[model samples]
Target: MDGFDNLSASEKAEATELQRMIAVEQQKAQFQAQVHSFTDVCWDKCVDTPGSKLDYRTETCLVSCVERFIDTTLSITNRFTQMVQKGTQ
Candidate 1:
């Protein structure tokens, strides 16, 4: 690409907006990857395959699984922070 100094004002603005859109797309992709990973693990533990679309029981279980996973993460984070504060490895 030519240097930004050679670009017209509108071209520069377009480039900047394109860069922002790319960043947003990257963030969305990363979030999707995390969700897929989480779903895979949680499905293994909670899902038994779809039986005619999602049943309420399975839906509830999946919700609980995600909630508990996040709760576990938060608990571990707090504990690790306390350990660091106390200079404990």
Candidate 2:
């Protein structure tokens, strides 16, 4: 018998929905981890030392670093996607 055979239609639907929600949450967690990693790397490269207040120059460098990191990530992802698509074709 199937795992869900004992469930009513409504119950099965609810279980499926819950599974989808769990998958979504997992993806969100993974994305958060990637962002944290990016921030750590960018911080080391952009900031000279910790200060009580962020000076304008340091603030600008941090912002630019993050933007470039994001752009690089997107470019790599797009290239990988294209490669996968080409391989499948």
Measured by lDDT, the strongest candidate is 2
TM-score, candidate 1, is: 0.58
Give the C-alpha miss distance for residue 89 in model 1, angstroms.
Answer: 25
lDDT for residue 42 in candidate 1, whole number 0-100? 82
lDDT of candidate 2 over 1-89, digit per residue (tens)? 54888899999999899999999999999999988987898789878989899889988888998888889989999999999999999
Pairs in steric clash, model 2: none
Error of 2 at 20 (Å): 1.2
**Model 1: which residue pairs collide?**
none
Q: Estimate, for each residue in 5-80, the C-alpha lDDT of model 1 and write its tens digit.
A: 8889999999899999999999999878868977998888777876767788888888998888878878998999
Stretches off by above 4 angstroms in model 2 are 1-8
For candidate 2, the per-residue lDDT at 6 reads: 88
Where is model 1 poorest over a 10-residue stretch in terms of lDDT?
Answer: 45-54
lDDT of 2 at 73: 88
